[model samples]
Target: MHVENSLTHYCIPCDETVCCACVSSRHAQHQTADLVEYIKQKKIDISKHKIQIAAEHLPQLTKELEVLKQAKEVYQISADKVTSKAQERAELMKQVIDLVLDSQLSEIQKVKDRDLDTFIFRENEICFQIEDMKKIVADENGGENAESESDFNIISAEREMKQKLESFSISERSRPLPPKFIQGIDDMIPEISRLLGKVERVGEIDGGVTQRKSAAEVKVQIMNTVSCAKPGHKVTSICQTSSNDVIVAYNTQKSIDFIDRNGRKLKAKKLQFETQDITMNKKGDLFLTVNDSSLIYKMKTPGNPTQLYNGGPYKALGLCAQKNGNLAAALWKQEEGIIAIINSGGKLTETISYDRTGNKLFKKPYRICENSNGDLIVTDSALKTVTGVDPRRHRRFQYNGGTEAKNFIPIGVACDSSARIIVSNWKGNSVHLLTSDGEFFRFILSSRENVTYPHALSIDSLHRLWIAQKEKVVIVKYLK
Candidate 1:
């Protein structure tokens, strides 16, 4: 639609197909080329542009083709690898099939050999019994009214063997034997039956016969662990201090010793008398509950102590600190069974007792922690259950030593801020985790070299388990 003006000399420079007559006349000398020649030059320029565009596209097309070729080669390599692996597996399967067939044939041959042994044994035993009977009959013919005691013993032994065969037959009749196995055993049955019939025809006689059943023996392989030195005392209680040092109380020595993380002994003075269970309170105070003693001792500082709880006819097995400034203890009473609760200043705040279903807090209980909106996860060693009691005094979760539960005897209980309950079972010698609802998570297997006889457990701020054991203490970080 463009037209060249008079000032412009070339139509191409003006980008026009035609120019006005005055423009053509004024530029006649500047552009004297013919119109047909101009058209030819324009066509040449168009061809050059087309060639440039094609050259630009060629590299891109080449790059795309190279990429496709690489992808195809990679796929072919992976396919070849997979096919080779499948062929190897098929060859291994064939070898295993051949081995199985050989094993089966060998088992069949063993059965045949055992059947032949059984037939021979039965025939020899029958012949021996017949010969003994004939000897007794010959002795009677020699004018002996009473047979010798040896003859009577032989008869008694034969009778016992016959009775054993009869019992075996009776026991075997209820179930149908495999036809192949029964066919292998058929040859000995006739001779065995004939011997039994002969023994039955001998009639009843009095003889002192001793029937002995082979005792069943169970082989238990007990590998005795020899780790610690032979201390002059037994470990009465174990506790961990704030500095991660384990304190083991010995009853005979009447002392507590500092133990390293590797269960190596350290020099520490013993606290006096039968230390049964030891625990540490929030103020880093060491507390010891003496067995069969009414008083509990608290060490404000190391080697300096004072009696905290006196005037009590109870024995404490476990002690823990509540979130508040109170002490929770598992106490055994003469009249009542073991009860776990927090006794603040000799006043019971929260008491837990069991019913028929082993539910704790079934009765009305008060001050069960308003901040903690979940159940009171308590491990009962006597009842072998971990009971969960809601704040409203309702039994919400219960896991016991039933066929379904994993724990055997739960002794200690500790809960995290996230309401994950950790329980240590004395029988299992391992720690178990339970959700807030008492469902099992998994067991923490005891590291034999470091941890053994785990009796108590607590979770730290970082969710790592601080376990209390007999010989040493262990800390395990739980992974999310």
Candidate 2:
């Protein structure tokens, strides 16, 4: 409780003022003094504190202020330099704009003149025809010479009319469309990309850069690239013999080319049979599948290809030699998909049609390969899936990419010695690796590595990858 006593005392030990009633209660044990005398002593202490502050702290604060001003002046100089550089850039940009304008204007004037000349010529020709026809009509309509015209004049006039009619032609050139103003940033990405290059901060400190997940990384080396430069030829399928020689199949050109790992062209031949797939068997003989059930084979010599077997009425697309020396072919029977296994003696042994759940294995299976473990790997283009089949002709696993698979249209399938499968994603523009059990493991190739629109895939005996691009093939050395 506070007292309203006008008289107060200074409790020196507590450094507080107290009323008479309070000095006798809460501060009864503290030493006390007169309030007026304590005020006079405090005023003296304040004077001494001001003198200390002016001597020590004030000079230090002034020095700090001067340092701040100097640092700000340095920043101001740099700012001035930046402003000057920007002005210079602006002047250069204006000059370039003027040059571009002049070039575009000249092209426009040329097109305009050409179009106007053609239009004027056509108009004058039509005008002359109209005037000649009108004069003949006027003369025939009794313009003072209708009754007096002789037979020679009439015959000559008729011949002239026939000549004009026969020679009349309104030749039309392909219409020239008005030029459209194309927006260019330059392809800002293209020709002049190096001109006004990117401006970025120098000596940027790296902060928490992202690393690709180890699970999503698989290293592969590109050994060589074999370019298929034959005009009108497109790569369809690829196969490698046990000796690491590559055979590239092309459809439009009706050709199969042979090349080594060094990209040297060994030989090429235009095949007599329409080839849907090509592969070499255990005897180093080539097996060629036509669009139908006909299978053609040839010895190492490029002689006349012999039709090995013709299974009736089925469309065959892709086939591969199995570990057991049998040939497994993807056949279309009655608009359905079947993998037919042919014995070494060129007779149909078994056909796999459905999975364990009675689900159709494939809608349209095109490319096929057999793993070292006798698991037949097939790429179903219509279903966009890569399926694995065991030696028993039973469906083992089917993969269409996982949840992370984007636009996953699988095109090519290859198996290595480890039974690992590689599938090329056409729409995704990437190549993916799969575990032996048909699970998506990681991406081994992508568009960033120039693996765009990849189609055919094959693995040689050395476990190297031969990937076919649009017009070229690359032999890549696979890593773990």
Candidate 3:
């Protein structure tokens, strides 16, 4: 008996071989293509995939694997050195009890084992991924199935393999293994000696672990004041541009002056209305609010200003930019004020007018800032408090100068890189540092600094605090 041609055609949907009769009988409505033609296109696709894997994906993964291997080696070397040092110290203390020595050695060994296990597990994981990727490249090059595999089978395999390779590419972007082991035995040296009975009491690690500098550790010293603008111009707001140039907005003049680090006026832009508040966005564009209208204008340069927000009934008093490319405007209507978050196209995305309890949130919101954690920090001038609102416009907490912050009257608000909210006191002539959640941290600048009329506050890229006074700009180095 003669066998029919069963693999004359390919069913694209079912991904299988089919004869002429089967194509018409079962897969008549399905997409069918010539087996030879399908195989030809699949071969081309497989060739391109192989090139991507070899030229791009494999090389990157191989580099990452090498890095992981080197890290593992370093970890092993450090473990060996720690173990050897413990042994030498134990040998020197010949009169020490065997039980105490063993305990000390056991502690060292525990650290070594734990770190090595983590390093090895990470190393093996990278190695396995590398090998799997290599296998994919090899399979795409038709490892052993080149001769007999059907076209449908080849196409299906290539699709699945490409997905896995793409997934590997994505995983490489966020690989979690640290470049080197950071934990060390330096903290355990004294403890090890005391545990060996060399002293009557047990010793603790001098510094258990490395810690970040807290807000309390930060100290501020007034560097110097520079006359940024003209004599009669009152500094209304101050911000640092992306080019590290300080820009000061003046109330008396319809202009904003850009000053360099050495306090030289580099450029100035004349505005139509007196500048009320000015802030720099991440793109280095300036957003300014005028005293006359409710609109906010975005100025890429001095003369060319485009209206950003012109909708709400309240007049814009202060302007600030969020990290997500949204602008926060302190809008005031008579005695009540609201923090409105506007998009780039001058549309309001959210408004912070009321708290979760349906109570009004702000009395007179001015000088708005967004913290690193997405909380809006507003200086409520009327209430004499600084309030933090969540992304959902709910009140997180409020700072009313507490007992130490007498006569607070917060005016300009800014959050530093360390997530500390710095609020300038209008009447107290000092600046208060609060935690991001509005808890009172400490006074960064006290009234003792001889600061008079501290109004607008800003934190520069170097973590230096900039205070806008009457006609001068004060720069203070508050963080190292």
Identify the candidate with maximal lDDT: 3
Query: How much RMSD separates candidate 1 from the native structure?
Result: 34.2
Cα lDDT of candidate 3 equals 0.76
Better of 1 and 3 by TM-score: 3
Pick out the ten consecutive residues of candidate 2 with the lowest summed lDDT.
203-212
lDDT, candidate 3, at 57: 50
Model 3: per-residue Cα lDDT over 114-231, one tens digit each: 7678767767877888999887778657766657778899899879877876755434444344334444588767766576534222221111212323334455677778887667
Which structure among the candidates has the greatest TM-score?
A: 3
lDDT of 1: 0.55
Q: Candidate 2 regions off by >4 Å?
A: 1-218, 291-302, 403-406
Candidate 3 lDDT at 106 equals: 82
Stretches of candidate 1 above 4 Å error? 1-246, 250-253, 259-267, 338-350, 354-376, 390-394, 401-407, 446-453, 458-463, 466-475, 478-480
Name the lDDT of candidate 2: 0.73
Error of 2 at 345 (Å): 2.4
User: In each prediction, how many residue pairs overlap at the backbone (N, C-alpha, C within less than 3 A)?
Assistant: 2, 2, 0
Per-residue accuracy of model 2 over 384-434 as CA lDDT, tens digit each: 788898755688898987643557788788887556888888877788777
TM-score of each: 0.43, 0.53, 0.55
Q: State the C-alpha lDDT per candidate.
A: 0.55, 0.73, 0.76
